[model samples]
Target: MKSESIVVVGAGVIGLDVALVLAKRGYGRNTTIIAEHLPGDTSINYTSPWAGANFSAISASDANALRWDKLGYAYLLSLAAKDDKDAFVKESTSTEYWDEMPSPAKIDSMAKYLKNFKEIPAGDLPSGVAYGIEFTTITLNAPMHIRYLLRKLTEEYGVRVVRKRVSDITSGFLSKDTKVVFNCTGNASRDLNGVQDSKCYPTRGQILLAKAPHIQQNVMRHGKDYETYVIPRPYSNGNVILGGFMQKGVSTADTFSYETESILSRTTAMLPSLASSETQILAAFSGLRPSREGGARVSKEVIQVDGTGRQGVLVHNYGAGGTGFQAGYGMAIEAANTVAEELQALA
Candidate 1:
């Protein structure tokens, strides 16, 4: 067997997950993460800190996306059930409302683990909603969870995270032992040297976090014009996250006061407890989801190493948009599989 070494670019949820998958595949001792940002950093470029990170069948209609989601959901369930206090994944009742019937395929797939899953009566749903699905799922406190992944990667997998950005993918393929480079650069892929994906752009999102310990579930309203969601973080006396607007073609990460007020208004109306007298505003922020024109790109490509005739594969894994955390592990598994194939061919 070839002595395997891998370099994963970016350190957001997606990057970290990809590295974790690589480690799990027995590359733990040879994985290195190169990124300009890490878990605790707060910036527009880092989307993980600003996510209402939860496990939902958001891509129920897409076969590929759904496969990733189901895999991630099962993995998280295992973590949550294992009694590891720092697992950062917890179960909650989740509800998603739509204006019409969801795809039968989606409903069927969810029924596998969502034993309590059921369609809601139109009368019980919020006004203007035509259908709904309620099921048990998990939510992640992204900041805390990112830190947890960092520790896991280091302590358990021997993966090291380097605080630096790359100008080219070949930089990671420099080592004679490095067989492949995983490009998990998120939106940075739009401008990153050697992987300028013009289709990559930001789908901006904003949310307000408020103190609401009594709220214990996740609720989402899906519509043609607007979408609203309320996710309660059950750990660390964490605040409830109320969101948001999916302003496509927007790149700014500045918080809009009115948007905050609008989210508060909509979420409180959906979950009245959010408007309780004891509720207090904790914070409001914005993030740019790494969205691509076609959807997430999780395939591999071969690139010639700079100044050297040798060639190596560059596995692309960005453009996950808002569901980065939700779809992270699943995508990572895919990336890892790609890496394994490339390594095998090299051998």
Candidate 2:
């Protein structure tokens, strides 16, 4: 039988992951990625590169989100265990401090990976922190991980990527034989011709990359009005990522100097090594996360082309917000399953 042809819209984490899963599931050689940007290109519109790219199990109570988080954790853990040099995944100690007691659902979601998990005593907790959790989690160098996935898709799975700005789902597919389409465009789903999800919006995030290899563990501080994080990448002499506010409904990617200072201040309080005289501030980056009023949209839909009256199968896997890297693999698996079901229905 000929390999099934699939057109995957978007080249961010979600799109790349879905394409990879489809190829692994017998869609090899004919799977193609159509996107305006590729893995290495760093743009404000592309959210993957700007991410701290760590798996902290922040899904909390949502059953669907938790399932995807667990799946991604297992998949990434397996990849990190590999001895390959390009595996950009690593294990790290994660400490999350909250001003109030964290929800039980959040605790339950992370219990699966609780090796040495502990709750910080109120006395030992920071001045404002009421509770805290310490556990090991997976973190990835976002750019490196994306490149690794791209290589795996092309070299190993025979998947191909095409650079194009798609206005609609119908025009996104380049392969004439494409029978199915996976709409994985992140924030672009808000304006894409066929999708135009009104609920879709952008959540702006900014991060400061600094040279702080001495910082080994990942730390997150959840305050009443502010949130901050410190993520250290161990490989490639990677820089420590000091992350910042989640400005909801903000679309502009401009980096604010004040926000950068706030990130440094908060992260420095957590890890003094970041303020060390030798530490160098490498760069600052901001990106708009593809957020939706509701949680991520990952389902199958039949979309009709404007010019061509024919209908096509569209497996939507976008609007993951900041959890894109952490949940990409799991969501992609779900998208691929939808594709399989659609193909079976057609057959």
Candidate 3:
């Protein structure tokens, strides 16, 4: 029998990662990634590009999230070790000074999963830091990582990436040959004609990217009012990602009036050494995270329209919220398994 073709919407990290996994499983020759935006083209519509994208699960108690995050962390660290080291790298990260520390239940699970987990020494703790923990985590340079995935998919798996805005799936663009449609459209899923999931909303996040002098690790501080983090980028871009503010339902793409200056001021205050660095302000950007009514919706379902038994299967993999890159591989694996099952049913 001929292979079943799959149309994966969105070329962001999740979409691309799903396509790659599907291809690796011998489904690549039959997969296509259709999207309105691609990597390297930073737009408000695409959230994958503008991400601090580290792997620290705030949802340790949530079984599904815990599984996804653990799988994702393992996958990312493996990729960092074998592939281009510069593409993704793991470094020591410190989370310090929380008004309230994480619940004991979650901390116990975290300790079991992380290989390099440890407590910060009392002497090294920041002024307000009452307690802190350090762990090994990976950070990704979105543009470079996405490009690398695309290149690998095209070169090794023969996966096709189509640059087009898909308003509806039932249109002529998809046909009987397309047995499975993985909806990884991120924020655009809300506007998709056939799949208008009203529960899908955007969470606005803004960040400042600046060149800092020789900072090679990650630092995060929690306060009564706000949380601050500084993450190093690839190849000593001399620039670190300083962010962020999570303003739910704020969809405007442009940088807000106060947010632009505020992020820089706040970040510099946290790391005093950044004050005298002769670094340049690269850019300030924002993206809307695609959040769903209930956390991430990674289920398979069938939609009927106009009494026609279209019989197309949708493996919904959107709603990573702000942690798309962190949970991407794990979610994609789940999505790929769903696609395989759907294809088997079709056969």
Candidate 4:
């Protein structure tokens, strides 16, 4: 019998992470990745690189997303502590609020997992901010992390990555031996031929990167009007990410609006030291987060092509919205487990 081959669509963080998990689990050696976009390319269709790429616990009361977030947080922290520390950093993050009250149960739930959980004294918080929560979380330099994952997949696991656009799955590319297909196309899923899921939509988020001097650690402020967060990148890069605005159904990628500027100005005003500093504005970028109506959609199904009686397994792992990096590992694990189970049954 010939070995099975699987083709994973999309090369963003989600795709690469799933590929890594599949490879690690002793999958087919002929696995290949067909993607129109890859890391380091600042394309609007790809949202992995534009993330503030930190582990912030903001999922709703859904059980699956909550499980994925918790699992991903532990995986990222382990990576940061073990070998990827230079690329990923674990630090104490302070989430402060102004006139917004997060549930104590939610805060305590997050604290149980993070290290150094605490509430700030009234005097220590910024004016008009009544509460704060400090806890440990991981941050990743998204470009570097994605590149690292790709490198590992290629160099270590021998997975093949090809740069191509896949319009239809049943065309000439798929084979009888191809038992499963994993879709991680992020925002492009709405247009991708075989998987035109109408529920998939883009939530546009814009961010500003500036070289801040001597500021370390992550800070976030939440309010009814706006939410702002600043995360320090790895390697003392001096570049911190200031963001962001979440506009739903807006797909324009060009960073031309003054609205993003206003967002940055408001964020800096919340952290005055960042505004008054001499930090040079490096760049402003926008990414459309792949968000579904309910939450992230991960499931397994068998799809029958037009003429081919052969059915191929389709495992969807997209609709992460803005929390891709934080939920990448766990979701990949779950998706891979589903694929493995399907493959085992077929065998």
Candidate 5:
């Protein structure tokens, strides 16, 4: 049942996970990861390395979306439990605040898998918050974990990597042997040739890294107007990220002083320990979250391979926005299954 080789474009978290899943599912030796950016490369266009990378999701209403959330949550929990340093996931705590109390249905549904889930008492709540939930969660050393994936894909799983820019599917298709192409290009799909999906857009997020060793837990406040969070990079020494705003369609990388101060004011207020004199600012930056107007697209299509007469299957697993890290594996599993089904039909 072995088919022709496959090509995977993009090396971000979503793409890497997709490659890893494909490798694990018996497509190991024939897959190649081609991308403009790889792990350890920093660019405003690259979002995975800059993630808060926590294992929490906003209240997802769609059952399929919720299933992805739970699947990813469980996968991450397993990694956190493992003692491997390269995996870089560790058990942590999450306390999420809401400006108004969520529906009873919402709480009940989320609590089903939120280990150590509890409603924080009103007396302990900070001002300007109406409802809060605390649960056991996990944080990732994102960069380290991504590099680990790349290493495992190449060395352990026999997958190959070609770190190059794919100008477009027609001109940049990596191989003639490729029977299926997975477009995990993230937000780059808006301009990718042969598939410029207008639904793709960028949600710019700003962050400030701080030396806050005393702060070990994640805290977030969600409101109709805004959202703010403090996430500790677990294995990184004394580092935590304070962020942010999802300014849709904004691509500028400017980190304004006022915006920086605003992030500092809001995040430190949530955790007074962060404002201590011992804490020092390390860096400030921004990245564009790859977003689609109607959530992520994990569907399949039969299109001309490299604009040639020969047709091939193309599976898309991009446009995850901020939810990419949390629901990535779930999406990858589905994408891999789609690849399998398409190959079976071709057979």
Candidate 6:
């Protein structure tokens, strides 16, 4: 193994972070990132840009998931510490209301990892809430975060980025001798050649962006299969994200008026002023979350390069669903470690 040539098949936050970490580990120059779309471009296929990118341990009950969140929290905290310019991420208070009580083990995990985690007093809990918790978490400007990641990979780390559609994961291969390949193609894996993951499915998320600078904190309400959240953008003339649904197997580009109205109606109850004319509601759009059954696939797999006799280390890092931003760093670190270990073993 030369520890020189590598390929990552997407440019979303997950792929970018994986490339960045590998670059830092001395795979800088020869590493190539191939993607159909790059940062600053708008498309329904690109989900990270449309995210209300924030940190929440709502998905961190499993030990592996919690570990990823923990690593991400520490890394995100470092960004918040030096965010005098509000470049990457911002720290904010997050209050979550659940219609059904989460298991005590889940609450304990949040308490152990989340900053200033606490159970909301019964009097403090809002109506229709069976459980509540308050904690400090970090929110990100999704667009800025991805662009910054791209700059770091190209400028700071000398990683190469290619803009082209790949028919399959193997299309990103630069050379037959390539020691490692990362599959970060999100939901594309379902139809993606050489990786038709039948379990990979799409979950559509709808959100409304409004100018609500007065709202500085994050609020989330979960009931049965539906969820509504209010996430104020870090520093964007008071733009807040109001959302959403996890409609499985739905990937239509259409945005319905009733869906927007429903979001506004439910969210306005939490922040009455959001209904006022003073708060201008901007765009209403939807994107597909690349969800997989049985959670994200974050492991090492060995495989032959199709027709080629040579084999390479393939690190699976996609299927994060909506938790990509919250758990990206940890997953990147874990994937990069595997690349390093395998490269050494092959060498």
Give me the displacement of residue 83 in model 3, in angstroms. 0.8
lDDT of each: 0.82, 0.80, 0.75, 0.76, 0.83, 0.82
**Candidate 5: what lDDT?**
0.83
Model 5 residue 232 CA deviation in Å? 0.9
Q: Where does model 6 exceed 4 Å of error?
A: 1-4, 83-86, 345-347
Candidate 4: segments with Cα more than 4 A from true spot: 1-4, 28-30, 85-92, 96-99, 103-105, 121-124, 128-130, 169-173, 345-347
- TM-scores for all candidates? 0.94, 0.94, 0.90, 0.91, 0.93, 0.95
lDDT of 5 by residue, 64-171 (tens): 567777888888888778744678888889999988776676677678987899989998888888999999887888788898899988888888888888777543
- Assess candidate 4 and give its TM-score to the true structure: 0.91
Residue by residue across 31-69, what tens digits does model 1's lDDT show? 788889998899998888888878765563677777877
Q: Per-residue error at 50 for model 4, in Å?
A: 1.0
Tens digits of per-residue lDDT for model 4, 63-137: 677778878888888888786654555554656554567766556666678767777877887877867877777
**lDDT tens digits, residue span 1-347, model 6:** 43236888889999998988877777777688889989998788888888887887456467767778888888888878885244568889999999898778768777887888988998888888999999998989888888888988899888888898988666656677577889888888788887888888888999998998778889988878888899988867788999988798999878989999999988988767676766888899898888888777887777776685667677888888888888888989998887666655543
RMSD of 3: 2.5
- In model 2, residue pairs whose N, Cα or C atoms come closer than 3 Å (at least 3 residues apart or on different chains), thus clashing, are none
- Give one digit per residue, the lDDT tens place, for model 2 in 1-347: 23336788888999998987877776767677888999899898888878887887444358778888878888887887883358688888999888877778877767756556777767788787888888877889988888888889889988877888977777754544667888888888888888899999998888888887678889998777667898887585857888887888987777889888889888888777777887788888888888887689999877674456767677889999879988889998887877676555433
Inter-residue clash pairs, candidate 4 = none
Q: Tens digits of per-residue lDDT for model 3 on 1-347?
A: 22337888889999998988887777777787888888778888888888875666443346667777777888887887777454655544545345466667656766787758887787877677666788887877776788778888888898887888866755413666777888898887787887788888998878878887566677776665565778777654567888777677889888875886777787777777777747577888887888876778788887752256666677889888867887888899998887677656544
Query: If both were scored by lDDT, which would come out higher, candidate 3 or candidate 6?
Result: 6
- Clash pairs of candidate 1? none
Model 1 per-residue lDDT at 168: 78
How many Å off is the CA of 172 in candidate 6? 2.4
